[model samples]
Target: MELKKVIILGTTQFSVMMCSILESEGYSVYAYSTYKEYLNSNFFMGCPVFLTEDLVELMGGVENFMILNTIGYSKLNTIRERTFADLKMREYDIMTFISQKANIYTDKIGQGCIVMPGCFIGNNIVLGESNVIYTNTVLTHDISIGAYNFIGANVVIGGNVTMDTNNFVGMNSVIKNRVSVGSYSIIGCGSNVIASIKSYSVYTGNPAVHKKNILDINSVNI
Candidate 1:
């Protein structure tokens, strides 16, 4: 049996991680980058870098390869979300990557999601499209996560929690059971979320509280 061909979209360090993982999964991995420097270099992480303009022709067609966006939590994940949307609009098949080391108990994952190694996804979880679940995160039973969310490493989301779209849950954070995290909210690293969060709010501290609305800020450093 022939291995599947995949084109990962990014030149970031995250792209290199995906390249290694995809190759381990029996994919003939290639990279696509908007960076002209990558084009001159010709390779990224041992995979050939294909230019954006020549991608379709080089791949023979969009049907010949799958696309996985390697954009991480930068810009509160607006860039990653937009890139996923653009790929969908262009009719490319987006890949959902669950690392072989991940322990998944549900089959309800959506398109373009990347579940990193050492993650544990429990029963009755619904993970939406283009979300990034970083290493060692635990999603307990009966949780619902929306599209474009960034769940950082070693975070523990308790059972029956509801997390909305485009939210950033920082590393080592603990979202208590049955808590509801609103859309566009930022749960700061190592915080303990004991209560329901409001939409667009920035939360931190032992028992997370609303710091400020995300829209009011000029930029978010998370």
Candidate 2:
């Protein structure tokens, strides 16, 4: 299905990247920022930007409009979670984007996801909502990724791996087959995951090991 008018929910650099991809898909892209000062930006990659606070009064209706969240996964993705929840409360149809260059073998993609260019998603993969899979990543068969996960660029995941909610897997990481990463975990960049990871933890190194229990992970300086 093709969408016409789309609104993005952040003014980040990644937001500009999302805007470029959407414009390639023939979307009339608009941006809404939670920060009031950013509203003064006349253009974000050629699209008009606005403040989310002013959206309801100025725009007559949004019946035909859909919103794409551009919030990144930092500080355990609390900002992204909040933005998503607020948009859902307003009952907006959240838009998902898969690059034309992506080779998606299955149709199990969820709403509000962003799959960047050169990604190879193999068969029977159940990708959850609001997950960001960046460029050149490789996901093999039967992998299940839970919601709100940020998988960074050039990562490789083997078959039958299961990932739980709210995880930020850093760039160039490698996950072996049948491995499961629990909820609210962070996989540091370039690490190799051979075994299952527990919830509320941080793992790094060649063979990924538990560094800390991060239930309050955000408090530890990122």
Candidate 3:
């Protein structure tokens, strides 16, 4: 049997929780703390801890080490891109982490998919590559999410929901049962989606309405 070595960046409580999950899955974990206080915590006793600022210096010839970003923020796309770029330049393999407690009943979870703690996934959920599901995000039965989708924290997705590629679902957003969200669409934070959203649209507010076209804009923060 082969053993996987994973390195988690960011030394928050979330990082420790993820490390525990990975360790239970038979992966050797190294926790990187951005703050010195986190390094001294009892939660990281069994795992090797390092300073985030000194990653480049400490990563000497360590190939095939999976780096998981445990930072919780809305603007994660830019952060992920930057981190991946840096790791790639150094020839390190990047990896994603999904909690063992997550109720995943999917046929396949794509590469680079990160499922955070307290996430509840239902049966027959098909998720594409590079999708991130933050903490407490709930996807009911028969949900389908496309590639490069960012599902924010505490979002609730009802059963039979289909979301296309490159969609951004904001925090606390709720998608009603059987709703279909189109490609490149953006759901604003705290919005409630009750109907099918069109492609490249920006939907927001309670009972989500199509406010504008997100594709017209140059940049999305996430």
lDDT score of residue 7 within candidate 3:
78
TM-score of 1: 0.91
Candidate 1 lDDT for residue 3: 49
Name the better of 1 and 3 by TM-score.
Answer: 1
Question: Which residue pairs collide in model 3, if any?
Answer: none
TM-score of each: 0.91, 0.89, 0.68
- Better TM-score candidate (2, 3): 2
Residue-wise lDDT of candidate 1 within 15-38, one digit each (tens)?
Answer: 887888877867777565653544
The lDDT ranking, best first, is 1, 2, 3
**Regions of model 1 farther than 4 Å from truth:** 35-43, 216-218
Give the winner by lDDT: 1 or 2: 1
Per-residue CA lDDT of model 2 for 55-156, tens digit only, reads 555465667677788898877776777778777776766788888889999899988888998999999999988899999999999999988899999999
Across 1-222, the per-residue lDDT of candidate 3 in tens digits comes to 776567787666767876777877778885554535446653454666776545656766556456776654334344544554555565655575677767777757876678877898888889876678988999988888876677989999999998887677899999999989987778999999999999878899998898987654346664
The weakest ten consecutive residues by lDDT in model 1 span 30-39
Residue pairs in collision within model 1: none
Q: How many pairs of residues in model 3 come into backbone collision?
A: 0
Candidates in descending TM-score order? 1, 2, 3
- In order of listing, the candidates' clash counts read 0, 0, 0
